[model samples]
Target: MNFSLVREMMRKDLQEVRKNGYVFYSLLLLPIMLVVISVIDSFAIALSSSGKASMLLPTFSTILVFIPAIITSLIGSTSVILEKNNHSLEPLLATPITDSELFAGKALAPLSIGILLSWLAFTLYMAIMDVLTYGHLGYFLFPTELTLVQMFFLAPVTGMLGTFLTLLVSSKMKDVRAAQQVSALVVLPLLLLIFLPIIASGSDLLINLLAGVGFLIAALAIFFVSVKAFRRETILISWGK
Candidate 1:
């Protein structure tokens, strides 16, 4: 793989992601609101019913854990379609960059942003959790082994799955909005499998681990398969249609 080419492509995409106001905001707002609302609600609950705040941790964390995947899908799904609409894609496609390089480049920006935002949000959430739980547990209990795995491994894998699926979906789409809308579906499977808490016990731990493994495998397989399956001509034809 041409690392330079991949980096160049990633750089260009990142710049474009920032330049487009609506797209940038669309990518940024949901996760921020999600984190902010959850933290504020939990803080409010802790102020009132200290015992109940702990109960909300599992479900809230489960949702927060997947924010990266959500952000990835939203950004990834629209990445290509937006460029195509702007007539910027053809020039990029005509370059000497190989499909694998281009694919990696396209995937990097959304993947990086998704994971980075998730970590930041997780940090805020941890602080909130520590404060809320301190009165009861007397110490910070967040970022446990399970949380670490979810953030570092499971989340990225899930985001990759969404990225690859959305790229494939976007290939046939001329409309960025429609592509983004479809990309939303990719998060559902991750959500169903990663609910490791608030299920009456830790029984879901096994399920979440199995699901994470499955996502990692699927993301890897799809990335390689999609690179081979990617057809520049098909994309051109689809845009014309």
Candidate 2:
């Protein structure tokens, strides 16, 4: 409800995540490594097959979208634990913020970080693919319908769903490790995207569109349910301890 409060909460959450240099830096590593691997794979393809890297698009797109999905869980799982450990959870929950605003604040950091990372990987992957393909085809072969749908629509929704549910689950727990382990399940179903390469080679816009709209609806539903179920008491009084 309060946009300013949500912004402040997001800022504070990000600052806390940054304090743990390892986790924060590791978030950046996934996208970079994915981009590097994609380049190498496409380059090898170009050398052998005369540079039609279109076949690689779907695989990399599936993997790239996953970067945000993974980041969402990492950030959401750690947020409540970090606050509680630093003795900030009580005061954070006590702030003059509504449940909706509090949840928005908590969800925004991971959601935003996930989108940014996915976008970064998409941009870099597309750039390299365009360059490599252009050398032989004399035309860029990117911004495919499936890639766009996955990167812009599905990835963000997946991140939204992951962050909302993961944070809500983590809020009810005390152990950071346990929170992360549980939240990691949110990503398991998404692993099916890796199989997109099969359908991607055909440039299946219909399939991606259906999947994108489906995820959008699912994310919205989970978000509202999480908000309605959110209780500050659960954050600090979980398991009656």
Candidate 3:
């Protein structure tokens, strides 16, 4: 593993991703949208007499988990597909870099972007919740133990899962939209997990523990499998046609 080559590749991929205006715009807008939604929810909770605004925190955390995954999937798949269509990938592959180096470089940008943005969104969400509920609850009520675990532990894994699945699908499919559509399925189980409280019976602690363990295992498995299966030869062959 050549660290220099990996860094160079990551730099190049980041440049390419930055060139896409839509990706930049989407990244900019997503956090704002999340803040707006959360603010509105807080207001609604404030007006209601249920006095269970804190209970909604988990649901908000669950929703925040998806933001980075969706963003990374779009950017990751599009990055690979664009490189293929633009005839840039073959020339890059022709260089002296190894397949592992190339894959790591490609995966790093989207994975980092997703994780960073997810954490930022989570921070904003936490801030909003604390501000709105502090007046009502008489204390700062966010960054709970479970929320901390979810943000620091589960979110990165979910982002990596999205990045790996998107890159895998992109390498196999010529059509960007097709690759994205297929890669999107990787989050189906995660989406279902958001509804766990309603569909399954368990204490919050039990559910959070299960979800954290599950996502960590899945992320590690996907990362290894994706690295093993993503051959430079296969990607070139698929794109060449």
Candidate 4:
């Protein structure tokens, strides 16, 4: 493994991510809204006459995973698409790096950002729990250990897959808008998963887990296909006008 290449790629990728204010802001909004809603819900439950407070827990848990996917897709795919469409990908491939290395390097941005956001979200959740529970957070959310661990592991995988899937479309697309519109379709199923059960008065963890696994498998398939299709010759010919 080329550690230097990986490090350089990661640094440059982060720099590129920083330039995309919409992506950062979108990612930031998730945590901000979550924290705000949690606080408000905590207060509302404390004051309300109904016993419906506990119902909000599942919704909160779902957001921990969904936020990373949405934000990562927006930022990571845009960067890859811009480079490929502008004909810069040809020069990148002109280097001595193998396709695998380049793919790994290009993948770093979404992976890092997604994992970072998940960890931060967990931290925020913990902090809020402590405050809302009056330091007895452990008593209220027992068995959160497994749930948090799952989110930590799953968030990055989801983000990486979403980004790679979008990159695949972007690589083949000449119009950026068309690429984005198509890639945005990736989240519709996830949205349906989150909401359909709530509307139907039931939810199943097993179904959600199976859906996520399917997404991971599909993501892996798309990534390898993109790598195969990303030759310098093809990119130089199909890039922007």
lDDT of 4 by residue, 99-197 (tens): 666666777776677768776776676566556654432356422643454475556656766667666666676666766666677543654454454
Residue 5 shift from truth in candidate 2, angstroms? 0.9
Best first by lDDT, ranked: 2, 1, 3, 4
- For lDDT, candidate 2 versus 4, the one ahead is 2
By TM-score, how accurate is candidate 2?
Answer: 0.86
Global CA lDDT computed for model 2: 0.75
Cα lDDT of model 3 by residue, 123-222, tens digit: 8888887887788789897788766766786677767767776776677776777776766665545545554663243226567667767767876787
Worst 10 residues of 4 by lDDT: 195-204
How badly does each model clash, as a count of residue pairs?
A: 0, 0, 0, 0
Clashing pairs in 1: none
Candidate 2, superposed: residue stretches over 4 Å from native: 48-59, 185-202, 239-241
lDDT of 1 at 11: 88
TM-score of 3: 0.85
- What candidate 1 gets wrong by more than 4 Å, as runs, is 40-59, 185-206
TM-score of candidate 4 versus the correct structure, residues matched by position: 0.75
Instruction: State how far residue 14 of model 3 sits from its true place (Å).
Output: 2.2
- TM-score per prediction, in order, is 0.83, 0.86, 0.85, 0.75
Tell me how candidate 3 scores on lDDT: 0.71
lDDT of each: 0.72, 0.75, 0.71, 0.62
- Tell me how far the alpha carbon of residue 231 in candidate 3 is from the true structure, in angstroms, after superposition: 1.3
In model 2, state the lDDT of residue 97. Answer: 89
- Indicate whether candidate 1 or candidate 4 has the larger lDDT: 1
